[model samples]
Target: MSFLTLLDYASVLVFAASGAMVASRAQLDIVGFAFIACLTAVGGGTVRDLLLDRHPVFWVADPMPIVLAALMAVLVFFTAHLVESRLRWVVWLDSFALAIAVPAGTGAAIELGHGPVIVVLMGMATGAFGGLMRDVVCNEVPLVLKQGEPYVSCAMIGAMSAITLVWMELPLNIALLVCAAVTWASRASALLWGWSLPVYKSRPPRQ
Candidate 1:
């Protein structure tokens, strides 16, 4: 009903679908799909809530998120074979999830009156942790740790965008909209235009 609640549900659905896609890639069963989907749907939010000391956590407060995740997993489990590339589906779905989640997190921290740095960190955690957990549990390389990707940068920039807008006295909902826009655009650019950060290169000393 509320903007923050909308963001949370949107992120959960998209993230759950992404997690199910990963399960499809791993050839996991329906139960595995539900497990991974629920994990990925709420993992970041759970971490954020625990760190912020939100009572009962988000999912515990309302179990609908978990039920929604299971439903999404079921849908994906039956439909995954139709996708040309499950990996691409996972990445793209995750991009959308990250976009929504970063703002959701930033808004939550801001609502709690946390400072800007904490806001940004919570946003990044919300955008990244779910996918990281999904990948680790699926025995895949975590997307957050992938070389040359700007995932974390996108999250930080998204959160900062919200902070800037709020500092200028813009409405929180409007700021969150901007946050999601920037987050998705940044991630989409990386996927579509090959935008990336430079990775470390090692060289022999005194060569």
Candidate 2:
């Protein structure tokens, strides 16, 4: 397989690991865990494909991602005890997954002949929406939409930067590296510094 294809598979596995982390935390049964993990790993990609009018979606075409995600779910389920107290580990894993996925998603949009805005939006969606879905399904606030942190904004910036690099005719590998770095650094900074968008607050009652 080509190097890009290998990277795509790596992104899949990383995203699957993040999903499995969520499933384990939710204390789901084996089948439920696999289902949630697979859905969380591929849900965003599937949505992007449908939006871009790309048929067969990605995991559907390969089937390997699903199988790998299921395997990851099983492994994580059995190994949950080891990391049960390490919530930061889960956050970092998810951040890594998002970083890997951003470039892959951008490449997919470029392959589909999407314009820069659409391509960046699609990439950000692919990197973030699955986690949003997982959080919602788990009855928790969706991380991307929550205040007091930089989340989807990081994905958006990374994807848009990648699209800009592509428009500037940069090499694909270099563009991807830049984008992934943007994602990872943004997330890490948010975690370390508590960076977040300002939230609107209603004023006190007027006289």
Candidate 3:
């Protein structure tokens, strides 16, 4: 398979894993796992396609992605028992998904004529939002929403850097590699070192 195709498949698997992890946490059924997996795998791309006026969206154009996501969800659902730790699985799977998705989303947005600013936003959303939705649906605060890590911010930086490199005529492969590396590093650092952006809360009225 071509590199792009490989990236797509990797994204699907990772996203499916993210969703399935959340479903397991929620104690959801198999069907619920599949639903979350499919949404997490394709939701961002679906939104991107719609915004870009790209017809048929991605999963609609190929049934294979959905099938793969569902199958993977099933595997995760069944294997959840054998796994000794849930948090480890969720974090690693989410990290993997973010690494694949930021580049893919940025590339797609650039291809669709979006500028650097928009591409970065799209990339960040693509990397983080589906899982955010899954968390919200499960009645938990989304990771990206917390003041704990630089998740979406990392995605934005990587996407913008990639888009800038592309604008300067860099090859797609090189851009993808560089951006993916930076994104992964930033996110992993946040997770491992407890790095976070500063929160600037307004002081309460003098009491």
Pull out the clashing pairs in model 1.
none
Error of 3 at 80 (Å): 1.2
Candidate 3 positional error at 111, Å: 1.6
lDDT of 3 at 136: 77
lDDT of the structure predicted as candidate 1:
0.95
Q: What lDDT is reached at residue 41 by model 1?
A: 98
Against the true structure, candidate 1 reaches a TM-score of 0.97
The true-versus-predicted C-alpha distance at residue 105 of model 3, in Å, is: 0.6
What value does the lDDT take at residue 31 in candidate 2? 90
**Candidate 2 runs further than 4 Å off:** none
- Candidate 3 per-residue lDDT over residues 84-183, each given as its tens digit: 8886788778887888888877877777777778888878877887678777787767877877467788888888779878988999878987888888
Q: Write the residue-wise lDDT of candidate 2 on 1-207 in tens digits.
A: 654456567766776777777777787898987887887788778888888878888777889888988898888888877874645666888788888878878878887788888888888988887787877887767777777688888898899888888889998778888998998999888988888888876676852
lDDT of candidate model 2 versus the reference: 0.80
Highest TM-score: give the candidate number.
1
**Model 2 lDDT-worst window of ten:** 1-10
User: Is 1 or 3 the stronger prediction by lDDT?
Assistant: 1
Model 3 Cα shift for residue 92 (angstroms): 2.2
TM-score of each: 0.97, 0.92, 0.92
